[model samples]
Target: MSATLPNGSVLSLATTYGAAIPMTVLTNAAPPVATATAHGLTNGDILEVTSGWLGLDARPARVAGSTTNNFNLEGHDTADTTKYPVGSGLGSVRKVLTWTQISQVMDPATSGGEQRFVNWNYLEDGNASERSKPTNRSAKVLTLKLADDPAQPWNAVLAAADAAGTPRILRLALPGGSFLYYNVYVGFDPEPSLSFNNIMQLTVTLNSAARFIRYAS
Candidate 1:
C-alpha cells in the first residue's frame, strides 16, 4: 500500500469545449456503449456527457473500445432500467478542449456527496423492525480558498463563469499525476476578507452538477 501528499497539486478550469456529438443510443449494459455516428473519438478520450438519465447526465466518462460509430463508457453501468429508462438515455457528449490553471490556491475543501436512502416499515409490526435502501447520492461542493489578486488573468475567467451561470469542468491534478474532474457551476465571491497582516483571500465554490470522475496516474 502507498499514499501520496497533495503538496504539489494544482487546479484548473476548462476554458473551451468541442462541439457536442449527438449520442443516438446508450445500451443498458455494464460499461454501457454509446452510439454516435462518425464519432471520431479515439480510445482513452475523456468526454463530458449530457444525458436524460440523472445518473448519467453531466458526468465525465472515459472512452474505450472506440469504433466508427460507437464507444464504451469505460466503467459506467446503466443496466438498471428502473433508474436509466430506455429511449430516454440519449444525449450528447462534448470534449474538453483546453484548461486554464488557477494559481495561488490556498486551501481546498470538499463537502456533500452523501448517499441518501429510503426507509420502510411494516404497517402492522409487533417487532418494530425497519428496513432501508440506498437511493441517489448528493452532488459535491468544492470550496477553494485562494490568495486574491485582481490582476490575475484567471480571476476574470472566474467572474465570467459565475456571471454566465453555466456548468463547466474543473480538474484537480494531484502530486503523482492523478486527476479528479468535476462538472460544476462556478460561484465567485466578489468580496475578499480583510485581516491584519495576512494575504487578502477569497473563496470560490464549485457547485457540482454530477459525480466526479477520477483518473489514476
Candidate 2:
C-alpha cells in the first residue's frame, strides 16, 4: 500500500520566504531611504510597493541600494520631504506559511459572488426564484488555525498589516507541486481561547483581496 500527503500540505518556510518586507519611511532624502530591519533582500530584487509614499502604488520598484536596516528606492524621489510624510509603510509583501504555525488552511472559493431574485405572483414565472444578474463577487476568505507564535514570520507580516492597514500575499504549494497564491488581508490577534491543558491555538481569518491563482510548479 502507498501513502499520500494531504493535498493542502504547505511546502515552504514562512520565516525566510517572502517577496518583500514592509519598509518604514525615513530621512526623506532624494530617492528615499526606507527601513526594514534584517530585510534579507538583495540589490535589484524587483519589489511591488503599496501606498508607502504619497504617490506609490502596486508598481514594480527595485532596490537600488541597501544597508542592514535601510534601502534606497530606485528613481523614486520625494521633492518636498515635508509633504511626503514619514511612517507610511509598504504592503502586498508576498509570503509563505509555516508547517507548524498553521494547523489547516481551508480551500479557497468565492464566498458569495452571485445574486438571485424571486418572481412576483403576477410575473408568470414557473419557478419560485430566478437567477438574477451576478455582480460584486468577493474573493474567497481563507480561514486558518495557527499555533500562536510570536516569533513566526506570519506574525510579523500580520503586525505590519494591522499597523499599516495593508495586505500581504499568501502562497501555498500543494503536494503535487502546484502553487496556490492569494492576496490576504489578515485579522490581527483574534480572541484566544485556551484551556489549562490543551495547546494554545489562534484562529486567523484571512480575506482574499483577489481571486486565487494556481500555477504549475
Candidate 3:
C-alpha cells in the first residue's frame, strides 16, 4: 500500500521554458574582404566597420523630428570656410562585412538598385523572440554591408561584375530579425559641398524591402 495526496500529481506552471538558441546570421553576399578566417567574417558571422570617416552622423537618414543636430564638421573648408555649418562633426569609417559571414539576405521578387544590410542586432543571443519564433515570410533585410562612400556607389560594385549594366544582389536574414536594404544613390553628406575632411559621414536612408522572420529554439 502507498500513501498519496489527491494533488500529488500537480505540476508547477510558470513562464520558465527551454533555453533559447542564439540566432544565427548567415550570408553569401559579397566577396570576402580579407579571408574568412583572417578577418572574422566567415561561416555566416562577422564584425565590420560600416563607417569610413570618424564622427559625424553616418546614418543615411536621421530620425524624424530628432532635432539633436549632433552633426558636426571637424575641419576647415578650403573653398568656403564662411559657408561651413557651425556644428557638423566627424563622419564614419566604411566597414565591410564579407558575404560568408551571413546566413541569408532578404530579397523580393521585384526590386530596384540598392542592396545592403539593414539590421545587425535584430537577431542575437539576448532576444528570446529571435530564437524561438518562426520567421515572417515577408520580412525585409539587407543583403550586404553598404558603404556611404560617395565615390563607390552601388552602380560601381554591380558594374564591376555586370557586363550588361544590371546589378546582381544576394539575400540573407538574421535569426533575431534584421532589415535587408539597398543604396539608391550615393552623394556627398548632408552638407552643401564636399571637403577633404575625414570627419564627414555618410548615412544610409533605409527602407523595408520585404517582410519575413524565423526563430531557432
Top candidate, metric TM-score: 1
Worst 10 residues of 3 by lDDT: 8-17
Q: TM-scores, in order shown?
A: 0.84, 0.47, 0.18
Q: After superposition, how far is residue 205 of candidate 3 from its true place, in Å?
A: 2.6
For all candidates in order, the CA lDDT equals 0.87, 0.55, 0.24
Q: lDDT at 99 for candidate 3?
A: 31
lDDT, model 1: 0.87
Q: Which stretches of candidate 2 lie over 4 Å from their true place?
A: 1-8, 11-138
Better of 1 and 3 by lDDT: 1
Model 3: lDDT to the true structure: 0.24
Q: Return the lDDT, model 2, position 18.
A: 53
Error of 3 at 80 (Å): 63
Report the C-alpha displacement of residue 200, candidate 3, in angstroms: 1.5
Model 3 error, position 109 (Å): 25
Consecutive 10-residue window with the lowest summed lDDT within model 2: 92-101
Write candidate 3's Cα lDDT for 93-165 as tens digits: 1222323222111221333334433343354556543323333344233223233344433434333323332
lDDT order, best first, reads 1, 2, 3
